[model samples]
Target: MSSKPLLLLTPALAVIGLLFGGGLALALLQSVGYLAALGQTTLTLDAYRQLLSDPVFGRSLLLTLWIAVASTAVSTLLALMAALTLRRSFRARPVATFIFQSNLPIPHLVGAIGILLLFSQSGFLARLSHLLGLIQQPADFPALVFDPYGLGIMLEYIWKS
Candidate 1:
């Protein structure tokens, strides 16, 4: 009921307005071509229009949408199956639960590096393959790290999620 409550809220409100509001405003301005540093002062929808009109852009957008949908569907299915199995009785239930959840606590960067170490062409798998005569050299192994289909990324997603 006193001025103290208003004073206490003022600084918090100002900080939120300065940080969150400023960030949103900056993003909106830059998205509409208002980046002074980049010399993009004109505000126009030409970029958006071009992206929509270009056939290559359209194909890329469709492919992105397809990958998103497929990844989501598969992730959901796999999660459901895991959930069902975890709730049922099994001898190695503890081990299964541990394996399913171990990735949860891991940082995303660590998980990504783990995936790279295991799956990259010059990774442990590739080196082992070479030693086992599966491939003459690590470089000769198929490029799985940055392949067009991004299988390594998908595997990382599945393992982490």
Candidate 2:
């Protein structure tokens, strides 16, 4: 509303615009195979056609469905439970409420990486499983990284936002 506040917000807004807008432009270019350094500047739909014909891409579609459903269920359940828990009066209700929403301040990238490190095929859980003899090799572990069920991605979504 004022010149002072406008001046204060200008730099932050500029940085955010540059980062988000530039990344989006780059992604749009790459989606059509326009990476000049890689000599892939053909800008064709061949990549999309390849994905359509690949079984793994089909499986990825299924995995995306799984991630969406699981993340929605988990976040909704957590929100409902938190609301119920905070409904009643208690000495520590304020603290509990803040704790319930603590994840809101976390960056999405950090939360996603945290989930990956904790749950991916070669992640903490995998190493723990190996140490405990629960799995014989890395391949023996469940496909939580790029799984049909998207276990890692679901956890990331639920934890991040």
Candidate 3:
């Protein structure tokens, strides 16, 4: 009986091993080629040296790191708040969970577009402002979408994630 179960599981295990092992082998080969010159086959750290000296690459790396750190911190805080709130009140628990889980079904790009539509100068909010006499035209509204500070991306993350 035990042998039968093992036999049945063998193919699945082999498939998983092949998938992961193939990927690892490809990555290893690529990394080796990347670390060494193809013609001379001499190992060198030239790529790493270049990466460290490139200002644009450095700036992008720093921006990525900042975004990762900020997102992690915010997610931790939000998770704690959600847990505490759930413990205190059960009334909106289902609704809150539904809203949070619903975000998973929406693509990131769609969420970004929604944020842009809602918060951009020519967006729904701006139109509402115009209707309310807060702004004479959309062009008079301040920029929110694609701002240098990445407020649009942050808003999208907050809404979706």
Candidate 4:
């Protein structure tokens, strides 16, 4: 074969160059203040320093780690349970498989919204409770949507995953 490595490598090289080159350009622009608006050309390390020092960011990072750990642990347990359950033949296997596969086609965001609508204080559960005389009104419903410990996000991950 003729020596034509550049011709053979052009497409792959172009993709690699575009990805890294664009990332480097953006980084340089951000670092040098080139991307800033009018009269904001001052170069500083304030952004980096603030990011390193912020308490909220620190807590958020910790929360993210905990969420990831919890999700992984829960998913592993669930997968084990599913494996054990599937090991035994049952009449519900087809229905369970269908539900599991159906979930694959529904987007996570849609599931999150559905969960919110079903579990929120003014949601379907609350209405059902009121109709069953368990509660006087939606306002009397207990909190579930805006829980302080990120239950909603955790539930969404569990359902989606």
Error of 4 at 22 (Å): 3.5
Ranking by TM-score: 4, 1, 3, 2
Model 3 RMSD in angstroms? 4.3
Each prediction's TM-score versus the true structure: 0.70, 0.54, 0.69, 0.74
Give lDDT per model, in order: 0.84, 0.84, 0.78, 0.82
Residue 120 error, candidate 2, Å: 4.7
Model 2 ranges with Cα > 4 A deviation: 1-51, 120-148
Query: Over the stretch 15-124, how does candidate 2's per-residue lDDT look in tens digits?
Result: 99999999999998999889998887788988889889999888878877877887999989987887898999999998997886788888888888887787777888
Worst 10 residues of 1 by lDDT: 62-71
Cα RMSD for candidates in order = 4.9, 6.7, 4.3, 4.0
Q: lDDT tens string, model 1, 1-161?
A: 68999899999999998999999999988877798998889998877887889999987776677656766778889999999999999999999999998889898788789989988998999999999999999988887778766667667777778
Best by lDDT: 1
Off by over 4 Å in 4: 1-17, 28-43
What tens digits encode model 3's per-residue C-alpha lDDT throughout 108-147? 9999888888899989999999999999997778787767
- Native-to-model Cα distance after best TM-score fit, residue 55 in candidate 2, in Å: 2.7
Q: What is the lDDT of residue 126 in candidate 2?
A: 86
Of candidates 4 and 3, the better by TM-score: 4
Q: Is candidate 2 or 3 superior in TM-score?
A: 3
Give candidate 1 misplaced runs (Cα > 4 Å).
1-26, 35-42, 50-63
